[model samples]
Target: MKFSDIIGHEEVRNEFDGLIKIGKISHAHIICGEDGSGKSFIARELAAKILGKTEIKDYADLIEWKINSGKKSISVDQVRSIIEEVNKKPYEGDKKVIIIHDADYITIQGQNALLKTIEEPPRGVFILLLCETMGRLLDTIRSRCQLHKIKKLPKEEMLAFINRKYGVLEDKEIKSILAFSVGVPGKVEDFMENTALKSIRDEVMDTLVSIKNMDYDNIVKCAQKLTEYKELWREVIECFAVYVRDSLIYKETGKEELIINSDKLEDVKKLAMQFSMNRLNRIFDILNFAKSNMESNVSVELTYGTMLFKIQEV
Candidate 1:
């Protein structure tokens, strides 16, 4: 895809374009961003420009390395394979683009194995490391590559994107997806295409809207129903977080334009009135506890039940 096709990050696009135009592009670069923030997509677009191709797919000179199926991290052997391949001349052109996806998952041993190649690659070889975080990378590796971080796109940019791509969807659905996406383009696709995820989003929104008024029996029943959507617990939690955050934002700013759940302006306004700042903060604490518990393999049913009760208490 063209850089112009990207949703945002005008500054980064301009800088990279300028660097490429002047033939001063770095041999190795690190593109860091949140997970599913399209770091690799941006890198691929840049690579396409560098190689004078409209796309990199099926291109002989473009190589990609990622954690394979059943693999937890990039192994040293996998890193070595790319290292050896970088020594070869480009297949079609003078330049080669090697993209390593999920580079944050590269084991310390794997990073060490690939350091030499990344530090001093053969002529015309460029490495693009796409990662969610750079904490796992060594200082040596970090210093060697030019780093470009991807930030959340502007609300306008994000709105324009979903409007153009998903114009057929209802306004409320679009807004809900937009709120959940939080300016991350890659995630928009996931929510749009997954019916179950959309259902879970609806359930979460419904729960948040009704929780305060829910009787004890209803609260327990609601929590139990959520257990059936076990695999989508993260999405459920994020939906809660985003909705509550929107309520908090509305309460403080009293501006619908500033809230992510703009389509739910009336509901959000009501939500904001029901909870004080202290109550909202306590709700956040409950969310954090629920998230931590889920990650720790705690009982999902128990976790949801407790979270619902705690939220009611506040």
Candidate 2:
């Protein structure tokens, strides 16, 4: 994809284009952003432009590296191979571009292996590192690269893009999708394509509403059901958090417009009555803790079980 094809980040696009026009390309660049925020897309497009090719596949000088499926980290051997490759002259283009997708997956050893190349690359060599967050990378590695932080599209921009691409969706449906997207277009597109995701979201909301009343056996069953969709646990947790937060807001302001789950206004209002402000705050904290723990390699079933029990107590 070309830079023009990217929906947002106009300022960043302009800056890159200006840099290219001025012939002052940096040897190393770190493109950091949330997943589904177009970090990889932008990096590839920039690499293509740097290689003077209209398409990525047509650019013989472009070397792409990504973490293999089911792999926790990109190994040091992979970085070493790229180091060897970069030492050679470009085969078909004036510039050689290396795009490392999910750069955060590069282990400490891998990062150290890449350090010398990044520090003193050959002429016409450019390295683009795409990562979800910069904190995972070594500070020394980060210091050697020009950092570009990409953010998600604003609500209006995202809605416009969704409308243009998906045609007409119900207003409520659009709002629901936006709520789930958390400002990420890739996420919005995923919600659009995966019909089952919406159903699962609804199921999560229903289960959460009834969780406090469930017996121990039923709670275990509920956790088991959640575990079956472990791949979507993050989204489920975020959606549930938003629902609880909106209920609390509605309780305070009595403003239906302020609630994201507008279709479930009555239910939210009833649930709001059941939770005092402090109780709702604690539940929100529990959901956020669950998300953090899940990212730290905690067991999904155990995390969900604990979260559910804490919600029941709240």
Candidate 3:
């Protein structure tokens, strides 16, 4: 994908081009943005330009040499391999590109291995580093590179992207997905692909409704049903997040257009009336923790049971 194809971040795109146009492109650049704001996409796009592969191919194709900087650290082994690749010289383009995704995942050793090269980069070698937070990066690494920041797309552009990709969804569906997706396009795609996400969303609302009416047993049943599938538990957490977010928007703007759980706005309104902000925040925190733990192989039963008990307290 080229800069023109990136859906948003006009300013950043222009900055990127200007650097290339002047033939003074930085050897190392740190591209930082929130999750799903397309940091990796932009990195690959820049690499394509450097490698003289401008045509857009399948997303999967661009990931041919992709390496995961495992767990919170980019291995020194990966850094050495990248250095070896660059030493082969530019094959067909003006520059050779090394695009390192998740720069924050690079360990101190990896960063140290990279420092001398970054400080005195070879002619025709361009490095693009992508991260969510520059603060997490070593200052020595940050000092050698230029930083480009991208923001989440505005709602209109985000919705337009969804429409362009998936056509016009039902208004309620659009609101619900957009609100909960936190303006992340990848998450929006995931929401669209999973047909069961909607039903699971309704179940989350139902659980909230049960909480509203003091139907304690239904809350337990809701948790039990969610544990039936790992994916279902994730959906419950996602929808629940959107549900609370919609409540915040409802309390602030009173606009239905911004409500994520549009079909269950009334239920949200009722619960919003009943729950304190602190209560909502606490539940969201717990669910987020559960998601993190689940990713690390926490048992489904344990995750759901803990979540239900916490929600019961609320």
Per-candidate local distance difference test: 0.86, 0.85, 0.74
TM-score of 2: 0.89
Looking at model 3, residue 150 earns an lDDT score of 76
Q: Against the true structure, what is each candidate's TM-score?
A: 0.88, 0.89, 0.81
lDDT score, candidate 1, position 141: 91
Q: Per-residue lDDT for 1-314 in model 3, tens only?
A: 44466788778877777777787678789999977788777777766755556654443223223446345467888788777766665655546777777778777898899888878777878778888899878999999999999788888889888988888678877877776566778778877887677667777777765765556676667667887667566667777787877777777677877765666778879777767778877878888988987878898877877787787687
What lDDT, from 0 to 1, does candidate 1 have?
0.86
Clashes in each model (backbone N, CA, C under 3 Å)? 0, 0, 2
Worst 10 residues of 1 by lDDT: 1-10
lDDT of 3: 0.74
Candidate number achieving the greatest TM-score relative to the actual structure: 2
Which runs of model 2 end up more than 4 angstroms from their true locations? 53-58, 248-258
Model 3 spans > 4 angstroms off:
1-3, 50-65, 68-74, 132-136, 212-220, 228-236, 252-257, 288-292, 295-297
Clashes of 2: 0
Q: Kindly indicate the candidate among 1 and 2 with the higher lDDT.
A: 1
* Residue 11, candidate 2: alpha-carbon lDDT: 72
